[model samples]
Target chain A: ADTGAMAAARTRQAQLTKPLGALGDLEDISVRLAGVFGSDRPHPHGVAVLVAAGDHGVAAGPHPVSAYPPEVTPAMVANFLADTPAGLGGAAVNAIARSVGARVYVMDAGVNADLPPHPALVRAADLGAGGRRGTSDLRTGAAMSRDEAEALILAGAALARQAVQDGTDLIVPGEMGIGNTTPAAALTARLLGQDAAAVTGRGTGVDDATLERKVAAVRAALARGGSDPADPLGVLADLGGFEIAAMLGMMLQAAALGRAVILDGFVEGSAALLGVALAPALADFLFAAGECAEVGHAAQLAHLNLKPMFRLGLRLGEGTGGVLAAPMLLAAAATLREMQTFAEAGVPGGGA
Target chain B: ADTGAMAAARTRQAQLTKPLGALGDLEDISVRLAGVFGSDRPHPHGVAVLVAAGDHGVAAGPHPVSAYPPEVTPAMVANFLADTPAGLGGAAVNAIARSVGARVYVMDAGVNADLPPHPALVRAADLGAGGRRGTSDLRTGAAMSRDEAEALILAGAALARQAVQDGTDLIVPGEMGIGNTTPAAALTARLLGQDAAAVTGRGTGVDDATLERKVAAVRAALARGGSDPADPLGVLADLGGFEIAAMLGMMLQAAALGRAVILDGFVEGSAALLGVALAPALADFLFAAGECAEVGHAAQLAHLNLKPMFRLGLRLGEGTGGVLAAPMLLAAAATLREMQTFAEAGVPGGGA
Candidate 1:
């Protein structure tokens, strides 16, 4: 948490062979990471990706134009692990992770159906006591209890620490929650002090009419929960999904362990908003990988004053954007660590 | 040239792992090279960087905000090769060339000073001459004679062929002409079918009042040459530098030899415009490396329909931007060579 460490890391980064600030934001991230770890030679290892999956209760009612049935969450999660045909899970993430040497793990924070036990699936649900198949209706009900939110956070943090303790130096937290954009929108609206309509956007490609319905559904949920701006966490508990809660926890825990965390798109950005509010110091440890083209994401990032690493107009969740951005992160880290310094190269300085 | 060969190369590029268009403009360059060479595995070798040095006659008079005296051109070229205290030439270029595994060649196209004989210095004075020096009067003056322009082009092409025969697969042409911006502006105006005011800008930080004078100088040159927008080569001969002429020839020769050419910023972009104009087929061989902040650069690029490799707000004219961009080119080539295809990775297709 010492600011001096961050400053020192920045100094070391500037000293690298190349023009000052030539590498752009990557240089800033590398320096900050080095400072947090208090090492000039900060080796990024034990890189793992956390993909949290959950189903949104808002998706239960077919408003029309919603991509598929709510049951798709479990189906896709299964496909993600087994590499099945119906799944959007594998491939992109697999290639990107393999390229950057990051192990991928899927966390079942909340799903509609009972998932079969699998090694790749980590059960980290946050259903309150007397919890049934799902929590009370999030549309007109509380999304998750405070204790449940804390549990999700703890689970994410624990997983990150375990990865670090197991020799992972970098962690990319991603999510695959169906219709979770509703919760992300609600959370973004509350945190950024904007109306639900201002931050609400279509999830999984809905028509204008369905988009209006989704917006109304979010508004109804916000009104049902009293949408108190003072209690931002309450707003999240009232509308946040299991995966987002998990991401919030994961980011905080990763930062607490001094590992670099790459935040992906809107869902991840919402989680970052929460993480930043909870522990302001974690903001220094977080890197905005890329922004989603979703309406609410830009507002969330603007609230954080964060610039995305890349902008390829990607909207697919499940950490695909984060995975794609990993190569750039690797390049930045490598350049920072390996590039010869101007002093080392004997280039004339401003002093000359 | 067989269009089918280019198409095949594009197909091969698309087949390389990563996203189909994730590599952006780089994919196009590599594929074009592959098509030109008629080889699936086109290995770039015998890469040469031509650093053309010249003195602008216009800089001899008092100009507002000139960085150094006009004599600095030859002196800098000398310092570029020699390891003097004030020298920036040798080290930066050497470091970049070493980084990309390319060879560096300095060409004394039209330096104002008499020089000691050196192997690195190609004494092609007639081919490297600058426009009328020391005066803003460009009405009756020509930057280079028709014979000089032809000789420079021939020399450049010869140099490129020699490099290609020496096993180089790429060539980056650089320039070091002081006050060359005057001529560069005139060439840009002619190529883009715009008046000099549309393309003229503060080169190397000329003040507001002085920039007005520079614009006037460019307009005078354009009028004096009676520059025809349809005739780009004639415009270059009338108002271009020896380095620009040589670059045009080098690019044409590189294209003829089936080697890829990486165009630098505005100065090189001007050269590329001339090259493509001289041999329309050469347009297929050049890659614009970066979008410069120069006044006429974007217009010229738009005229050529070329997208720069990067946008770092660089305007340093000593081939630094081109050198910096080499890494991206190499990265693109490596990606094409190493990325796994969807079939190879056992990933599903988008049902194309």
Candidate 2:
């Protein structure tokens, strides 16, 4: 963030039509964009939604919290790619993306099932195959070796770099992984050093009995794979899924390229927390889309010192929240770029 | 509201790709739109922002709480009409309206000074002038006589009806009344039976001394103009501005026409509260755009059993919040209209 640009944006906001600071978070949003873009005025363009899809290893277990079977992951990815009649996630992402002229790309980081090729689809293993058949069972062992984790992270970084180089100014990081929140809860609990019951939530509308199972699964995963706060990659390899690791990689790489990343709900928040642990500066480049329906979302947001733009309690994470937020963010940037100052408008009150 | 359509929409929501209720308010928003449109799928179109602009006579009083002179109201109205250079409010409203294919219309319902005519400009005085110089001081006497109030309200209703007849599918109600929160706070306190200190907030970023003065203004207004919960029209004549009264009329008439109304922050919330007092069913047709920075907004929303869409702490009242929210609402509606169901998409195991 450029201090000169930020100061200029703030002074400009004070002189806008409304009273100083009357626009509240909307003003903050525009100023932040100006600082990031290093300009007195900034414009939003070349937006992209990156739906990082994968399947959680824990879903293979008989006692799963997910209402839908893990096979739904690959199917949804295919659904997003075809976008023919679109699914709920695809419908939302596509509609908002079209409204803001953003292109949608569905990335298969590590889904367990076979997926057909499509123009808007990319394989995460193009970075390197983190694993061929999803990840290892976190309840018993490491989800992936450190090398696999590194490869996945590097692949995500490479993808982020490619997008920025291709003229993508903003990245909305989203995910689709059945039973993924189980690992997410595990990762969150480990990184924050808390108990599983405190962070576990109803993933995919699970019953109370299933929620308890999820809590226990998270505890078992952490207990089996000891985590260290100093090593984010080690923790990710222990309790994280490919999609989560990939999202973290994207944030870090996007931040490095000075491209904004809108973090979706809880699933993406977990990846961001992990990314922050790896590189705290990544927070400067990230925007929280909304308060998610997941129970642990509040804790994660508070820990990250993030004020979410909206609070819709959205938990369906195909980057839907991020996509929904993109237009408003664009409006903020547009306000900075297009709104004439009182002086420029030659209105009687040239605000001091 | 269409009960059958709402019920059908809820049932269909469970069949979407994500878990039940994962979409939260977005789901509720779309369902309500479905009910209003009498369809399982609702689409937003021909959306226009009705900025109810007015001036408060109390602003001409000594020790007024308004930061800027009352003349800023008419100037801002003119700014909204000429969007080339764009004021802050104009820039935000226009950019967002354009993003979602909505048109911007500025209404000089009762600005104190003269405003120029434009293609998208309309004055309620075309219904018949309510007063020569905006509204009278509510702290001294009734803001307008029964006849003036009736004419203003009727004009609002007429405008709303004309828009619906002219193919408008949605109305975003906003306000631009300098020192108007004084009356809004008074109306809110009266309707909710609260005290001035409780409901009065810093309208447009007033300082501590000004906020205290605003509280006193509300107290004085309520004292001078006795209010009756049953007599909503009389209350408006006593304590509401022509703009606020007009907004209430627009909502009631638009609700009757089965058009969706997106209520902006506190000022619009106050008008909607008065509308609900007049007709409880009006609550069924309204959607809250965001949580306001004003102190009484939560109380106002609570009394109406309304859940706002976002919590951005926005206080700017130019239909800015509604225009910002329009994209998300469209995405929600498009979700219902375009998304394929779990069964329709086929590769799924729908949970029981």
Question: Could you give the C-alpha RMSD of every candidate to the true structure, in order shown?
Answer: 6.9, 2.4
> Can you give the DockQ of every candidate in the order shown?
0.10, 0.51
| Candidate 1 residue-wise lDDT, A14-79, digit = tens | 664333554445566666666656665455645678887877777776463245566656755665
User: After superposition, which runs of candidate 2 have C-alpha atoms over 4 Å from their true positions?
Assistant: A83-101, A165-167, A346-352, B83-92, B95-101, B165-167, B225-227
True-vs-predicted CA distance for residue A113, candidate 2, Å? 1.3
Runs in model 1 lying further than 4 Å from the true structure: A1-53, A64-90, A93-137, A158-172, A202-204, A226-232, A257-260, A289-291, A308-311, A317-352, B1-141, B145-183, B202-210, B242-264, B279-291, B306-352
> Model 1 chain A, poorest ten-residue lDDT window?
A126-135
Q: Write one digit per residue (lDDT tens) for candidate 2, span B1-352.
A: 9999999998888787667787888899889999999999786677877777888888886787877778778878777766574332354566566655676766778888867767777789887756446788888888877787778778788888778877787888878888888888888898999999999998877779988888877888888756686798888888888888888878999999999888888889889988898888999888888888889999998988888888887887888888777777777887777766778666486555
**What is candidate 1's CA lDDT for residue A8?**
66
Cα-based TM-score, every candidate: 0.70, 0.94
Give per-residue CA lDDT, model 2, range A31-143, as digits (tens).
88887788878875778888888887788878876877888888788667654643323445665566556667777888887777676777877668554558877888888
**Cα DockQ of the candidate 2 complex:** 0.51
iRMSD (1 decimal) for each model: 8.2, 2.8
- Fraction of native A-B contacts kept, per candidate: 0.00, 0.56
